[model samples]
Structures are given as C-alpha cells and as structure tokens.
Target: MNIAVIGTGYVGLVTGLCLAQVGHYVTCIDIDTNKIDQLQKGHSPIYEEGLDKLLRENRQQKRIEFTTDYDMGLADKQMILLAVGTPQKNDGSADLGALFSACRAIAEHLSTDVIVVTKSTVPIGTNERIQDYIKQHAVNNNAVSVVSVPEFLRQGSAVQDTFHGDRIVIGGENTEAVETVAEVYQPFNIPIIKTDLRSAEMIKYASNAFLAAKISFINEVANLCERAGANIDDVSRGVGMDKRIGNHFLKAGTGYGGSCFPKDLSAIIAYGRKVEQPLSILECVQRVNEKQMDILAGKVSKRFRGLKGITIAVLGLSFKPNTDDMRNAPSIPLIQKLIENGANINAFDPAATETAKTLLSDKVFYYETIDGALKGADCSIIITDWKEIIDYPIKLFKKHLARPIIFDGRNCFSLKIMKENGMEYYSIGRPAIFPIS
Candidate 1:
C-alpha cells in the first residue's frame, strides 16, 4: 500500500513509521523544511521512545520517506492521512484552520480516487464537513472519500500502543472507503470497530473526556482521603480489584495535563454547549483538574510558611515520562506560582531539559543532572513520574539538599522508604511523612 501522511507531528510521524514497518510504503508530508531535513537525515523532530530507531530503520529500508512537497507526496498514493493538529481556541472549540488547510491541499493535489482518512482528533461531524470541503474544491467531485480514523496512542508508549491497541475505530459513510483503510492496518491484528463518521469522531473526544474525568474523580477522592485520614492508595487498590471499574487511570496526581486531555475535554464541553446539550460533569472535571495544580502549589507554600527566597528543585518538566512534550504541563503553572511567590526554581528531566528551556527561559535554571538540581535546594518537587526519578538514590538526596523536604506529586516513591530515610515527605492522598522524633 502506498500511503501519504500529511502533517508530520507526533501522530503522523509514529503512524508513518509504524505503517512502513509493516511493509507499506509511506511518505510523510510536512511544511516545515527543518523537520523534513531532520527526518531525511534519520533524526526524529520529536522525542518519543523507540521512535527514532524505527524511523531510521524504515528510512534505511526505503519503506518511509519525508518531504515538504504535497503535490509529489500525494501523487499515486492510495490512502491519504490527515494527522494535523487541531488546537483549542479561546472559546474552547477546536481551531480547525490547520485541518481545513490540509483538506484543501489534498483536494487540490489529489488526481485520482483516494481514501482521505483523518487521524487527527476532531469534533463530531468533522468528517462530513471535510467531505463537503473537499468536494467543493476538488477537481473531480466523486474522486475522494473521507473517513474518520482517530488515533488513541499515548505519548510515551505510542509505538507499543500502536501495535497493541485494543481496537481501531473506522468511521465513514462509504463502506469501500472504510474497508480500504482497514486493509492498511489489517496486519496489526487489532479489532476494528466500524461506525458512522460522527460517532467515530465523537469517540475520540468522548474517550479522552472520560479518561480526564476519571483522573479528576480519583484526585477528588484522594483529596477526601487526605482530609478523612484514609489511604487513597489502599482504597484505589481495593476499588481497582473490581472487574467493573478496572484500575487504569486511577492514580491521583497534580492533574492531567498534556496535549490531549485539556484540549479534548474543552472541545467536548464547547461542542455540547453549541448543540444546547452541555455536559456539566465534564465541566467539573475540567475545573477540578485546574484546581489540582493550585492545590499542589498551595501545599508546598503552606509547608514553608512562605515561598519567599526559597530554593526549590523540580524533578521532571514534561507532563509525562519518556516524552519531551511540554504542552499544558502542570509544572508550567506550578513553577509560575513558585516564582511569583519569590521562590528560585531549579529543574531537571532526563529528556525534557531542552524543550523546557523554551518555556522557562531565564525564569528557571536547568540542571545537567537531577542531583545537581537538588544540590543546595530547600525542597524537591517531583512532577513527572519518570522511572529514573522514582528509582533515584536516596543517599544522594540526603547528601545534597540542606533540607530534605520532598513533595511527591505523582506518588512515585514508597512512603515507608521516605520515612526510613528521615526525609519529610508530602504526597497526595497519603499521610504526611515527617522526620521521626
């Protein structure tokens, strides 16, 4: 199969590489000359685990190619994938400028019958709109068919998730188009759910909103546990044991922040409002998620009486581990609050330092290593639960920091071990561990 992927962002890059790995010829199209140059040189523009290696292998085998030429990239391609970003606007609705631009480009360049599959997360009815848009601008009215195929891959584990996803949703009015898109992914052995274009688009937003709601719900429960002297960890464990609930996305943290949840939740709520059937629960979910970060910051502030002139070491700048994406990262707001309160910030992450620099600029200092970041710090805050931060040597922590006050935002460490190490530990939904008298 010859596939052309438009917009070589996270989803496009991963999709192209994964499809090429399965023996399909893929050409990823992007407008950024620098990104295309990097990809052509076997370097990934984004930092995703195992992505660069797969991309290099596929490029070496001539299975995948990168280019900025849309006319050339779309020529002779059987399937065209639109994986462009649909960023959220001020009104909470998705800004579809990029998506529409891609559609217009495809419409102009498409010379034959092609399946235009949308892998970008979009609002419901977007596929129908896309079909109409292409028809309006296309040279041949019946030459293109639009299909909605939303991606559900996580950032850190996207490669693995792409290959092992539980199900693939394909939504389109044309059966032939659906089947043609399905054939491309037939080798993955994942179950395929075929539905209408609207339902398929809604599934992506609904899925993300539900997961965000779950995280917020659990965080609220964790807050209750803290006030009620209950252990959220044990409660979560017991509740997760039930087959009905299942345990995924139960862990309480600072908040759910990344590219997907915040944008999707906002878009769904806005979509509901537009249709005069607003989702009140999701509104609360968004509110709670925003408050969670403030709560964490307040906890840190209350501990030190005031944040004025304190040196704070922040471990993990990315929203999650194994990816360098800083979109809507909780640390952004947390660090902002700390700085506003006169706290000096030192931060470190295994792979996010360079990315973090763009956001933090001179407001925060970036350290070469976690230990260096913690040195002479009054307290340490763990934002992302990267494996390295979770497994960091406790003795080194004791040796460097003047005061070993650790705030475990992700609960990445054991409470007992922090106690044994004689560190003042503060974690979500757990009893505060102070130095034993």
Candidate 2:
C-alpha cells in the first residue's frame, strides 16, 4: 500500500509510521515546514513511547518520508488518510475548519483513483460530509472513496496499542472501498468490524463517553468512601470483580483529562441538544469530572487554613504518564486555584516540563529534579503519578519538605507506607494518615 497521511500531529504521525512499519510506503504531509524538517532529520516532535524509534527505523528503511508539499505528497498515493485535528469549539461542537481545509487541498491535488480514510475522531455524518465536500472541490473528476476508520490508540502506549488492538473498524457505503481499507490493516491480524459511516463515528464518541463516565462514577464512589471511612481500593476491587464490568478505567484519581475525554463529551452533549435528545447522564458526568480536580486543592487549603505564603511541591504535570501532552491536564486548574489563593508552586515532570512552561503561569518554578521541586516546600502534591514520582524514596518527602505532608491526587502511596514513614498523607477515597508525634 502507498499511503499519504495529512496533518503530522499525534494521530497523523503515528498512523503514517505504523503503516510503514507494516510494509507500506508512507508519505507524511504537514503544512508546518519546521516540523517537516525535524521529521526529515529523523527526529520526532512529540514524546510518545517507541514512536521516535519507529520513525528513525522507517526512515532508514526508506519505507516512510515526510514533506510539506501537497502535490508531491498526494501524487501516486493509493490511499490518503485525513488525520487532522477537529478541535472542539466554544459551543461544544467540533470546529472542522482544519479537516475541511485538508479535504480541499487533497481534492485539488489528487490525480488518480484513491481511497480517503478519516483516522480522526469526528462527529456523526462527518464522513459523508467529507465525501460530498471532496467531490465538489476535486479539480479533476477522478474517483475518490471516503472511508471512516477512527483510530483507537492511547497516547502513552500508542505503539503497543496499534499492534495489539482488540478490533479494527472500517465503515463506508462502498463495499470495495471498505474492504480496501481493511486490507491496509490485514497485516496486523486484528479483528475487523464493518459498519455504516455514521455508526463508526458514533462508536468513537460512545467509547470515549462511556470511559469518561466510568472515571466520574468511580470518583464519586471515592468521595462517598471518604465520607463513610471506607477504602476506595477495596471498593473498586470488589466492584470490579464482576465479569460484566472489567477493571479498566476504574481507578479513582484526579478524573480523566487529555485530548480525548473532555472534548468528546462536550461535542456529543452539544449534538444531543441539536437533535432534541438531551444526554442527561453525560451532562452529569461532565459536571462530576469538572469538580474532581478541586478535591485535592480543597484538601490542601483546609489543612493550611489558607494558602497565603504556602510553597507547594507539585509532582507530574502531564495529563498522564509517558506522553508530553498537557491539554486539559488537571494540574493546570489545580495550580491556578492554589496560585490564586497566594500559594507558590515548584513543579517537575520527566517529559512535560517544556510543554507545561508554555501553559502554566510564569510564577511557577520548574525543576529539573523531583528533589529540587520538593526541597523546602510546605507540602507535596501528586498530580500525575509518573513512574519516577511513584518510585521516589518516601524519606525524601520527609527530608525535603518544611513539613512532611503529602496530598496525593493519584493515590500513588499505600496508607501503611505513609503511616510507617510518620508522614501526614491525604489521598482520594482513603483514610487520611496522621502519625502520632
């Protein structure tokens, strides 16, 4: 297969590289000259585990290439994948400006018969809209087949997810077009599901919504456990033992954040309103997640009576581990609220420091090491639970902080460990530990 993937963002880059890994000749197209130049030099712009290694290997094998030229990139390609970002608008509907612009360019540049597959998360009926838009703008009356094939790769472990995905979905009205897209994934040997274009789009939204609902539901349970003096770990384990509700996304933490959940929930809720079918459950889910981040901040504020003159050490800034993405990261709002109350913050993350500096306030002190962030701080807060933060010595929190206290949003430490260390610890859905002096 000879493929061209437009928009070299997370999805686009991963898709192009992985397809080339599976023996396809791939050309990654992007409008950003600097990003293309970086890729051309065998460097990846994003921090995804195993992605950079794959990019370098594929470039060495001559199986993948990067370019900013639309005509050259689209020429002689059997399939063109639209992996552009459809960012959420203020009104909660998806802003399809980037997607539409890409289609126009692709339609104008396309020279021969090609299958156009959308690997981006889009609203229902979006693939049909793309089909119509492409046909209208195509300079030459060449046959174009648009297929809906939304990606299901997780950010941190995208490479693993790609090769081990449980199922692959292909949706289109044209039988030959749908099968052709399936053939692209035949190398992976994953199960394939064929459905209509609208159903495929709905599957992506529904999957994100349900996963978001699980996180919110567990967080609510964690809150109830705290009031009732029950342990969330035990509760979740017992509840998740049932085969019907497997234990994925059941951890009680600072809610779900990333590029996916928040945006998808808002988009679907808005669509529900447009169709006169209110998604009341999802609306409540959204409300619960919005308040989850405040739980840790409230705990910190109550402990100190006020945040005035407080210096807090914040560990982990990215939405999750193994990725440098900070979009909708819970740490942003938590830090903002603490700062608004006059608290100073020192933060550190293995991969997110550079990206976080752009999003966080200039008042924040970014650190190269966890000890640097923790040294002399009033107390510590665990936001993302990266491996380094979890494995960090317990005595260091005691040795560095002005007061040996921790407010764990991710529940990274066990109660016994904190109690044995003689440290004050507060965590979600767990009993607070205060050692006897």
Candidate 3:
C-alpha cells in the first residue's frame, strides 16, 4: 500500500511509522519544512516510546519517507490519511479549519482513485463535509472516496496501543474504500467495526468523553471520601472488583489533563449544545476537573498557612509520564496558582523539561535533576508519576526539603514509606499523613 499521511503530529507520525513498519510504503507530509526535514533525517519531533526506533528502522529499510510538498507527496499514494490537528476553539468547538485546509489541498492534488481517510478526532458529520468538499473541488471527483478512520491510540503507550488496540472503526459511504482501508490494516490482527461516517466520528469523541467522565467520577468520590474519612483507594478497589466497572481510569488524581480528555469533553458538550441537547454529565466533568487542580493548590496553602514567598518544588511537568507532552498538564495551573500566592517554583521532569520550558519559561526554575529541584525546597508536589521520580532516593528527600512537606498529586509513593520516613505526606483521596513532631 502506498500511504500518504498528512500532518506529522502525534497521530500522523505514529500512523505513518506503524504502517511503514508493516511493510507499506508510507510518506508523511507536513507543511512545516523543519519538522519534515527532521523526520527525513530519522529524527522524531515528538517524543513517543518505540516511535523513534520504528521510524528509524522503516527509514533505513526505504519504506518510509517525509516531505513538505503536498502534491509531490500525494501524487503516487493510494491512501491519503488526513491526520491534521483539529484544536479546540475558545467556544469549546473543534476548530476544523486545519482539517478543511488539508482536504482542499488533497483535492487539488489527488489525481487517481484514492481513499481519503480521516484519522483525526473530528465531530460528527465532518466526514460528510470532507466528502462534499472533495466532490466539489477534487480534480478527479469520481476517483476519490472520503472515509473516517478515527485513531484510538493513547499517549505514553501509543505504539503498543496501536498494535494491540481492541478494535478499529472504519466509516465511509464507499464499500470499496472501506475494504481498501481494511486491507491496509490487515497486518495488525484487530477487529474492524464498519459503520457510517458520522458514527465513526462520534465513536472517538464518545470514548474520550466516557473515560473523562470516569476520571471525574472517581475524583468526585475521592473528594467525598476526604470529608467522610474514607479511603478512596479501598473504595475504588471495592467498586472496581464488580467486573462491570473494571478498574481503569479509576485512580483519583488532580483530575484528567491531557490533549484528549479535557478537549474532547468540552467538544462533546459543545456538540450537544448545537443540537439543543446539552451533555449535562460532561459539563459537570469539566467543572470537576478544573476544581480538582485548584483543590490541590488549596491543600498546599492550608498546610503552610499561606504559600506566599515559599519555595515549592514540583516533581513532574508532563501531564503523565513516559512522554514529553505538557499540553494541558495539571502542573501548569497548579504551579500558576501557587505562584499567584507568592510562591517560588522549582520543577523537574526527566523528559518534559524541554517542552515544559516552552510552557513555563519564566514562571518557574527548571532543574537538571530531581534532587536539584528538591534541594532546600520548602515543600514538594508530585504531579506526573514518572517512574524515575517515583524511584528517587527517599533519603535525599528527607535531607533536602526545608520542611519535608510532600504533596503527591499522583500518589507516587506508598503511605507506609512516607509514614516510616516521618514526612508530612498528602495525596489525592487519602488522609494526610502528618509527621510525628
């Protein structure tokens, strides 16, 4: 299969690399010349586990290529995957301008029969719009088919998830196009669910919204547990054992913050409002997530009387571990709140420091090492549960912090260890462990 993936972002990069790894000739197209050049040199702009190795291997094997020229990239391709960004607008709707622009560019250059599959997360009826746009503008109207094939890969484990995902959904008006896509993915032994274009688009948003709801639900319960003197961990375990709930996304943290959950929840709520049937549950979910971050800051403030002029160390900057993505990370707002209360911030992330520098350049001091970030700090806040941060020397923490106050947002350490260390430890949905003074 000759595949051309437009927009070499996270989804596009992974999709192109995975396809090329499976022996398909894949060419990734992007307007950013620097990024395209980087990829051509076997360099990945984004950080993903197993992605660099696969991309490098495929490039070495001459199965994968990268280019900035749209026409040249799509000229010989049988499948053009539209994997561009549909960023959320301020009004909470998905800004599909990039998607539509990509469609127009594809239409202008598409010469032969091809399936234009959307691997981007889009709203319902987006595929229909793409189909209409192609027919109206495509050079060869009768030769092109627009299909919606939404990606379900999760970050931090995208490569593994791609090959091991439970199922793939393909939506299109053309059976031949759907069959072509199915054949393309035949290397990965996963179930394929065929449906209409709208259903396929809805599936992506629906799945993300549901997972966000689960996180919010648990966080809400955790809040109640804090007041009621109940342990959320035990409560979650008891509920998760019911087989129906099945313990995933149940760990209560400083709420869900990433590219997908927060944006998807807002987009779904906006989509509902468009049809005059608002998603009340998602509205609550968004509110709870926002409040959770503030709650974490409040916990720190209450413990220290006030955060004014205090030196606080933040242990993680990425939204989650194993990737350097800081988009919508909870640490951003949490750190900002502390700074507003006159606190000086010092932070460390094994991988996300570079990306975090872009987001919080002057707001906080970046550290080369975790211990360096914690040195002489008044308090510590663990936001992202990176394995390295979790496995840091416990004694170093005891020696460095001026107050030894650790507010763990991700519950990285066990309660027993904190108790034994005689440090003031606070975590989500669990009782605060005060030091024995």
Q: Rate the local accuracy (lDDT) of all candidates.
A: 0.92, 0.94, 0.89
Model 3 worst lDDT window (10 residues): 135-144
List, in order, the clash count of every candidate structure. 0, 0, 0
lDDT of 3 by residue, 1-437 (tens): 89999999889999999999999999899999999989888889988999989987998899999999887899878999998988889999999999999998988997878889999999888888888888889776548888899999988999998998999999988998899999999899999999989999999999998988899999999999999988889999999998889999899899888888888787888989999999998899899999998887899899889999899999989899988888899988988888888999999998989888878848799998988899999989999999998999777898999888899898888778999999899998888898787
Task: Tell me the TM-score of model 2.
Answer: 0.99
Which sections of candidate 3 miss by over 4 Å? none
* Model 1: CA > 4 A from native: none
Question: How well does each candidate superpose onto the true structure, as a TM-score?
Answer: 0.99, 0.99, 0.98
Give a tens-digit lDDT track for model 1, residues 158-273.
99999999899999999998998899899999999999999999889888988998899999999999999998899899898898998999998999999999999999999999
RMSD of each: 0.9, 0.7, 1.0
Supply candidate 1's per-residue lDDT for 420.
96
Winner on TM-score between 2 and 3 is 2
What candidate 2 gets wrong by more than 4 Å, as runs, is none
* Candidate 3: Cα lDDT at 110: 75
Candidates by lDDT, descending order: 2, 1, 3
- Give the winner by lDDT: 2
lDDT score at residue 252, model 3, on the 0-100 scale: 89
